[model samples]
Target: MLCYEELREAVDNGYIIGDTLNVVRKNGKVFDYALPGEPVRPWEIVTVESLIDIMTELSNYQ
Candidate 1:
């Protein structure tokens, strides 16, 4: 799935909160958008699916 799509889904489902996103593109680029002073952090995932994805990424680096 696309990174933005996954982020959107997580937000819509209330799986993430209090943080913003910095999506890494397929071309190995990091894209982060934030307000001047809001300084939002990474989103919080309150779902199992998000946790699974995170674990998958971690294992890949191992």
Candidate 2:
């Protein structure tokens, strides 16, 4: 799995090429993500702590 920094860099560098991106959420927070054409269930399996971490990182960016 890609960490937040790597994911950001990949997106910034246009490395994540796709037509569909799925962002799974749980309790109004990001729970998981799937790339284009990747199958993903619409339920939360595990809590993703990175959502909060990424939010903090983004706030810092602002």
Largest lDDT belongs to which candidate? 2
Give the per-residue lDDT of model 2 (tens digit) for 1-62: 33456556655687554533345555555444555566666454533344445445444543
Q: lDDT of model 2 at residue 52? A: 47
Tens-digit per-residue lDDT, 1-62, candidate 1: 24445545665787555444333333332233232244454552222233344434534543
TM-score of each: 0.29, 0.40
Cα displacement (angstroms), candidate 1, residue 27, comes to: 9.9
The candidate maximizing TM-score is 2
**Native-to-model Cα distance after best TM-score fit, residue 58 in candidate 2, in Å:** 5.6
